[model samples]
Target chain A: MTTITKLPDPVAGGSKHPQRGKTPRPGRGRRLGDLRIALLFILPAMVGFVAFFLIPTIRGIYLSFTEYSVLGDPTWIGTKNYTAIFADELFWNAMAVTLQYVGLNIGFQTVIALGLALLMHRVAKSTLIRGALLLPFLVANVIVALLWFWMLDYQIGIVNEIINWFGLPRIAFFGSEQWAIPTIAGVNVWRHMGYTALLIFAGLQSIPSHVYEVASLDGASQTRTFWSITMPLLRPVLVLVLVVTVIGSFQVFDTVAVTTGGGPINASRVIQMYIYQKAFGESDFGYASALSVILFVILALVAFIQMKFLKGNESDLD
Target chain B: MKKTLGAVAAAAAIALSLSACGGSAPASSEAKGEINYWLWDANQLPAYQQCADDFTKANPDIKVKITQRGWDDYWTTLTNGFVAGTAPDVFTNHLSKYPEYAAKKQLLSLDDAVAKDGIKLDSYTKGLPELWVGQDGKRYGLPKDWDTVGLFYNKAMTDSAGLTAGQMANLDWNPKDGGSYELAIAHLTVDKNGKRGDEAGFDKNNVAVYGLGLAGGGSGQGQTEWSFLTATTGWTATDKNPWGTKFNYDDPRFQESIAWWAGLIDKGYMPKLETTVGASLADNFGAGKAAINTTGDWLIGQYQSYKGVETAFAPTPKGPEGKRASMFNGLADSIWAGTKNPAASVKWVEYLGSTACQDVVASKAVVFPAITTSADKAAEAFKAKGTDVSAFTTHVKDSTTFLFPIADKAAKVDGIMKPAMDAVLAGKKPASSLTEANSQVNALFK
Candidate 1:
C-alpha cells in the first residue's frame, strides 16, 4: 500500500532521494495503475451517485422554479412557488409539526440509546441482546408504523386494552390531533433507538479502556465518570448521531403517512408528508420541489451547526 | 486526476444512456404487437385475464399483457408512466382521476373508436357511458364496471336489536334530526353492561358495539360515508356535474348534513373518527364492533367472506329527498395517448366494455359490469352465491343514484376538504368551518 515519489528538492532532502528515479518511477507508475483499478472498482457507485442523486438534485432545484405537473413539460415561474410557499399557512404548520417531531424523536432516541449503550458497556454485551435491539430498525418503516398503529389503536389495540385494565381511559393515539405527532415520533423512536445505541456503543468501544481505568483509579464515581469522561468523549459520536437522526426525523413521512395521514386535522403532517402530498397527491410538483429545496437547506444548515458548535470532528479522545 | 475524471465521465455517460432507455417509444401502430394492460384490483385480475385470453383468441395478432398493482401504487405508477411515456396501452381508469388525465391530454379520446365499433352508449347502465365523456365532449374511456353505495349491516346484530328486515330497509333520515335511521343505529348499539345506546344507562364511552362504523371523513366526495345523506338534501358538490368551476361545499344543506353526520360521533352511536384511521370499516363491521356500515357494492364479497357473520345489504336510508340516494361510481378502461398500438388498444377496451367480456366479468360476481344485461347477470351471479345485492341494484333501478362528482383539481379539492371534514368529524371545528375550505376549493378553479 506504500507509494514512492521522486523528490524535487534533492539538495534539501538528499538522503531521502538516494533511490529517486530508478525505483520510484516504477512505484509511481504502479500507483497510477492502482488508481485506475480503484476508479474502475468504484465506477458503478459513482455512476449511481451521479445519475440518481446528483442529477435528480439538480433537476429538482431547476423544477422548483417551474410549474411541472408530471404530465407536461415544466414551465418556468421563477420565484412564484417560493413566494406561494412563504404565504402558505400549511407550510408553516408542517414546519412547526416537523420540528416538534424531530425534537421529540431525536431527544428521546438519543437519551435512550445513550443509556442502552452505557448499559451494554457496563453490564451485558451479548450479541443476542444487540440483535434483538436492532430488530425494529431492520423492519421497514411502513411495517413498523403499521405494527405500532394497531398496537396503539383507540379501541381495540392491546395498549388501550392494558390501559383500560388499569381503569384509565383509552388514548386515541393516532386519532386525536394532540397525540398524533408524538405517537408518530414515539413509533419512530422505538424503531431507531437500538441502531443509534449500537452506533454510540461502537464509539464507546473506540475510547481507550485505559482512560476509564484511570478514571476509576482516580476515585471518580459512576455519575462523575459518565458526565466528565464518557459524555465529553462520546461528543463526536453523539453529534454525528444527532445530525443523522435529527435530519431523518425532520423528514418523517411513512410513519405519519400510514398511521394518521396528517391528521385528525393536520396534526402529524410533517414537512415530507406535505411535500409528498403536494407532488404526488396534488400534482403540484413545482411547489413540492421548492418545499424540498427548503427542507434540504434546513437540513444542511442544521448539520453544519451541529458539527461546528459541538466540534464534532475534533475528538477529545486524542 | 484526469484519468479518474475520464472514467467518471464515461461511467456517467453510460448511466445516462441506460436511464434514457427506460423511456422507449411505444411500438409503432403499424406493428400489431402486444398491448400492455394495467389494473389495480387483484380480485378482478382473474376475470380480466379471462377476458384477455378470450381477446387474444379472437384478435390473435395483438397480445395483452396484464399488470396489477395495489390501488395506491397503481395510480402512482400510472402517473409516473405517463411522465416517462411508458404508460400501458390500456389501463383501468377511475372517475376521480380521468378528468385530470383528460385535461392534460394524456388519455386518447375514444369517440371515433366508439362510433366506428358501433358500441351503443345505451347498452350500458343509464349513466355509465356519459361518465366517461370529458368536458370537451370526447370520450376518454368506455365504462367497464359500475358501483353504487349501500348499507351493509350485520344481520345478527340487527335481528338481536329487535330490528326487522322490513324496518331496516325502510329507515329514513333527515339532517335536522337523524330520523328513524338514527333511532335504529342507537337501538343497535350495545354497551358492555348490555345497555343499548337508546337505553337509560347506556355508556357512550364504553360501548361494546358501535351502532355504525365510520369510514374516515370521506374527504370531498364522501361517497359511502355521508354522500347519500348530503345528496338527499339536494346539495351537489359543484355548480355543474363534470367540469363545474364553483364548489358548493359552503351550501347550508351540505353543511347541515355534515354537521348531523359528525354529531353521530358525539352521540356515541358511531365510532370516533380517530378510531377509523388505519382500521378497516368492513373489518370492524365483520368483527361485530359495529352493527351497520354503509359501504360500496364492490365490498359485497368482502363482507360475505367473513365466516360466521351473516351480512345483509339495505338500501341507504331514505333521505329528506324522499328516496334513498347513492353515489354511482363507474370504472372505465381508457387507452393511453402514447400507446403504440392504438387500434389494438381500442379493440381491447371495446371488448372489455362489450357484453362478451362484460358477461364473463359478470359471472365472476366480483363487481357489477357496466353493460345493462351484464349487470343483471352479475346480480344473478351474486344471488347464486347466496348474496342478494338488490340494495345496490335498486339505486339504478329506482334512478336514485347520483354521479360521482367529476371535476378538475379533484386532488386539490380533496386536500382542502379532507382536513376540513376531519376537523368537523373530530369535533374540533364545527361544520361551518367547511365554508372556508369551500372557498379554498373554489379558489383553485379560478
Candidate 2:
C-alpha cells in the first residue's frame, strides 16, 4: 500500500536527503529545493491549463449571458439566450437525439469492451492482439466516418452489396432518419470499443491473481467467481469507463457532421452539432456558448452522481 | 508559495504578451506591399495565380499572396479571421454572406474607389453590379463570375430512352401534371427488372437508375433543385430579396412545386433524400444510377470529367410561365475592413473584377466571367473543349433568370428550412409542413 501511494511521485525519490533529520517535516533548505524543482516541472502544464482551459471556461460562462455574433462586440443579453434555448423545440429535439445516441453508444461499447477485455485476459494476452484491436481508435474520427459511409452506402457500398446479394433490400444507413443516429453510434462504437477494451484489460491486470486462485480452490464455479469477486473488484474501473464514455458519447459531432450534417430532418442533430450550427453556421456564438455551458453543467452533475452512487473511489480489494 | 505565485504570474504574463504580439495588425496601409488574397475554389486558383503574376509584373511594388480552401473551411476560417483581425486583405465573397458582413462593417466599401477610378459598373452582366450594393447604398464588392443551373444528362441513357437532343432541350413542366419534363424523367428511369418508370410493372422500390438525381434538400434557396420550377410558377422566396423582411415559403404555388418535386422520389424518378446524403449526385449520374441531374454550371467541369461516361447539357425545362428559369448567382471579390494594405487590396480586387483577370479566367472555361464579353469568350472556350454550355447561358440571354435570394440571418433561414425541406423530401411530412417552418424563419426577421 505504501509503494502504491508512492508509485506516481517520481520526485519523491530524489527529494530524500540522508543529511536531513528523519522528521515528518523536512529541513527548510531541502523543502525549498523540492518546491522550486516541482514548480519548475509543473509550470508549463499549469500555464497551458490556465490559458487554454480555465480562462476559456470562464469566458465561455460569461459569454453565455451575452449576444455575440462573432462579428461585433458581445452585448449583454442576460438570460435571454438560455430562455430561448429552453423554449426552442430544435434544442429539445437535439437533446433527445443526443441522449438516444449516448444510450446506444455507451450501452453497446461497455458490454462489447468488457467481453473483449475478458477474452484477452483469459485467452489471448498478446500485445499484438491488443494493438490490432486498438487500430480503429488510432484512425481519425472523420476518416472512420467517411470509410464507413462508403462501405454502408445504400446503392453501391460493399455492405449494401452484400445485403443485396443475400436478396435483402439495401439499408439506407446514414440517409434514413430512423437509422442515422444508430448508424453514427455504431460507427463510433466500432472506433472506440478497442481502446475501451484495453482500458478494461489494464484494470483486469491490476486485480491480484491470488484472489482468483483462492476462489478456484474454494470450488467456486467460473460464473460464481466472476459475479461475486471479479465484478466487485472491477466496479471502480467500470464506473470510470462509464463516466468517460457517457460524457464522450454526449459530445458526438465529427461522425454525424461528416456523414449526416444533422439530417434526414433533425433526426441526428445532436447537441454539439446544434451548438456548432449556432456558432459557426448561424454566427450566434452567444447561444452556442450557452448551449456548451449547459452541456458542461450536465457533464459535471453526471460525473458527480456516477462517482457518488457507484462509490467509484473505493475498491473492494482495499 | 509567494515565490511560486510570482513565477506563475510571470509565466502567464509572458504567454499573454506573446499572444498579444501574435495578434498585432500589420504596419499602416500602403499601396505598395505584400497583400494576402483568399478564395474558396481550387479550380480558379491557377487562373488567378496567372492574374496575380501579371498584376505583379505591372505593379512590382505590390506582391500578392493567394490562399485557397474548400467551401466549408473557407467561410469558417474567414469568420474566425474577422474576429482575430487576421483576415486576408481581399477575399472572394458570396451574396448570402456579404450582406451580413456588410451589416457588421467587416467589408470595406468599394464605392469611393470605384468612383475615383471611374470603373464602369455597366461593364458587368446585368444585375451583377447591383448585388454588391449594400442596404446602406455602399458597394461592398466587385462582381467576378456568374453561374446558373441547367440539366446535365447521361447521353447514352437518354438516347436509349428514346430522348432526342431537341426533345431534351424543349421539355416543359407544370406543378399540376408535371408536363413533358416528368415524362422524360419517367421514360429515362429504369428498374432492376429493366422496366422504365413510365412502363407497366415498373418497380419503384428497386430502381436501378433514378431519372432525376436528388442534389439535396436545397435548404431555403433550392438553387439547383427546385428554384427553376418554383420561379416558373411565379413563386418567389421572399417578399423582396436582398433585405427582404418577409419570406414567402408558404405560398401554395411554391408548396405545390416542391410537392411535385418530392413526388418524384415516390415515383422512383428521383432517389430518396436519404440515399443522396453523403453520396455525390454527379457521381451517381456518372455511375449510371441516375439518368439526369439538375445542377449549377459550376459543376460542368466535374460532370464532364467522368471518364467513359458521355454527358451532355440541356436547358432547364420551360415552366408554366412559357419560359425557362434559373437562379442567377454570382461571386465577387471584396476587401476586408481590417486589412492594412487597403489600397493594394482594392487594386487587386479591381484587377480581379476587370477583364484583364476575367479574360484569363474565361480562357480556362472553368466559369463564366461577369463581364458580358468575357462570358462570351468563356462560351467559346467551352466550345473549344467540345462542350456546349448554351443550356446555362440561355437563361441569361432570354432574361428568365431570377436573382439568388439574399437576406440577413441567411444561415438561420437555412437552418429552419433545411430540416423542413428534408422532411418533405424524405416523405415524412407533406409540403404544407413548410408553412410552419416559414413562420419560424419570419420570426427571426422580426
Clashes of 1: 0
Clashing pairs in 2: none
Q: What are the lDDT figures for the candidates, one per model?
A: 0.86, 0.89
- Candidate closest to the true structure, highest DockQ: 1
TM-score of every candidate relative to the true structure: 0.90, 0.91
lDDT of 1 by residue, A175-211 (tens): 8788888888899889999999999999899888899
Q: Which pairs clash in model 1? A: none
For candidate 2, lDDT tens digit of each residue in B76-156?
A: 888777765568989999998999888877787887788778898999999999999999888998999999999999999
Worst 10 residues of 1 chain B by lDDT: B1-10
Positional deviation of residue B187's Cα in model 2 after best superposition, in angstroms = 0.8
Cα error of candidate 2 at position B90, Å: 1.2
Chain B TM-score for all candidates, comma-separated: 0.93, 0.94
Best by lDDT: 2
